[model samples]
Target: MAHSSNDEFFAKLVELFDYRKGKDHGSIVLTQKRLTYDQPLPEATSDTILPDLHPPQPMPILIRATNAKGKEKRRAKEKVKLSTVVDADNLPAFFERYAEVCKVGMNTLKPRDRRRKGKAKKKKGGAAAVGGP
Candidate 1:
């Protein structure tokens, strides 16, 4: 397999991230599971601390399908994102570098005023023909 360029890699990374725009109003709450209750239950009297466990990270994998003759075709190629186990020790450093790059990109953007001043409307007939008493 050949290595991809940094720009291509970054583009793929962004694509994998797949950030979405949030709703204009109200908040969106995410839940792992849904539960049905007849009435309100008692609140927790104490807090519980859970042990930290490292889980496998999910990474994207490009999958390709071969033709009937066992020939791989470009059109039949598909990207299958499969979960892979990997260490996340460098995640913090990666995030820091990403933030710095993002800051630089943001700085390059110039804020321009979008609102334009209204232009004066011109009269239909100039001076209205002085000859017509």
Candidate 2:
């Protein structure tokens, strides 16, 4: 990309990852041959582990920065494709890992209190601004 931020971009990525942590996954019916007892998505069992859902991440965005020196620094952007580039068989492992992350709780990965403080500040300032000086 045009190389502007490190923390901002990584923070965005972490947020994206957290959102994906509790991914809602649907299971495929392998044996449609009919079962005797009913089979709904099982509740959390002692042995079974349901991992979080995190789709394979896309490649980083590529940016082109024009104007070598001086004030005018216009930038053009190019979006890269979001493809897993992995074999179909190996995809199952990804799902399994996601489930594990879900089991562990996604909140742990969040950036912590700074986000909340920022929101609170914005709300306070926004309210005052909306009301008066």
What tens-digit string does per-residue lDDT give for candidate 2 at 1-133?
2333433433333444454456563111111121112333445555556511222332232212111222332223222111122234444564465355344544444353356566667798656645763
Clashing pairs in 1: none
Q: What residue runs in model 1 are displaced by over 4 Å at the alpha carbon?
A: 1-87, 108-133
lDDT of 2 at 76: 36
**Leading candidate by lDDT:** 2
Q: What's the count of clashing pairs in each model shown? A: 0, 7
TM-score of 1: 0.22
TM, every model? 0.22, 0.19
Instruction: Determine which window of 10 residues in candidate 1 has minimal summed lDDT.
Output: 27-36
How do the residues 11-125 of candidate 1 rate in per-residue lDDT, one tens digit apiece? 4434333321222222112111111123233344344232112112322222211112222533455332212211245445544654554444333245652332321122223
Looking at candidate 1, what is the lDDT of residue 19? 26
